[model samples]
Target: MEHDGQLELYTAVADQLKEAHARVRASQVPEGVRMALTRKLLVITAAAKHDLADAARRLESFMKDLDEGRIPEEDH
Candidate 1:
């Protein structure tokens, strides 16, 4: 991905995570609302966590290459 595209994607993900977290935190909402929002939050949280983990793995691989005095390449 281009640098700008990557930044935009990350920003959107962050905004979604914040919104989902807030929805889950609103305890005054009705049970039905809470249930629906909790599901949404869980889905988004899982997705975001997955993305983060992948990024971490890539970074680790890149750092390992750097330590071995080699340039890292894109995973894809």
Candidate 2:
């Protein structure tokens, strides 16, 4: 039962990650911003391997920022 719940959460997060990638790709942001966002997604993806719940929270915050037009500055 607990395992099944975890599996469902994993599946949902995976699907959300796919949609987030697509949204990033289709966004009209500058290249640098896009790259930064991609890096963030990559980190979230890696985190999911070790901590699904944490990764899901991170991904949710990321998506919320994106939806709210709160993009981070590009790294130097």
Candidate 3:
């Protein structure tokens, strides 16, 4: 995808996740249970963000290689 499209998709993903997290936070639950659940959710979100960062790094490297003529561009 083009840069603008990728950015739009990334923004959408972030917004959706934020909205979902807010909804979950607003739901009523026992304090202990809610704390445990929120902790797990935090771990999951952190892992996802880490993976996204790694993917972004790989994409950046790929784009740099292509731009520097170190990799061949496909005839798409």
Number of the top TM-score candidate: 2
TM-score for every candidate vs. truth?
Answer: 0.42, 0.96, 0.47
How much lDDT does each candidate structure score? 0.53, 0.97, 0.52
Q: Positional deviation of 18 in candidate 1, in angstroms?
A: 0.6
Candidate 3, after superposition: displacement of residue 49 in Å?
2.7
The numbered model that scores best in lDDT is 2
TM-score, candidate number 2: 0.96
Weakest 10 consecutive residues of candidate 3 by summed lDDT: 67-76
- Rank the candidate models, highest TM-score first: 2, 3, 1
Tell me the deviation in Å of residue 65 in model 3. 41
Per-residue alpha-carbon lDDT of candidate 2 for residues 15-35, written as tens digits (9 for 90 to 100): 999999999999998899999
* Count of clashes in candidate 2: 0
Q: What is the lDDT of candidate 1?
A: 0.53
Compute the lDDT of residue 34 as modeled in candidate 3: 47
Task: Summing lDDT over every window of 10 consecutive residues in candidate 2, give the lowest-scoring window.
Answer: 67-76
**lDDT per residue (tens digit) for residues 1-76 in model 3:** 5878767756754664565456447745455644654554465456556675544444444335434544332222
Q: Enumerate clash totals for all models, in the order shown.
A: 0, 0, 0
Kindly list the per-residue Cα lDDT of model 1 for residues 3-58, writing each as its tens digit: 78767766766665565456347546556655654564555556556685444344
lDDT of 3: 0.52
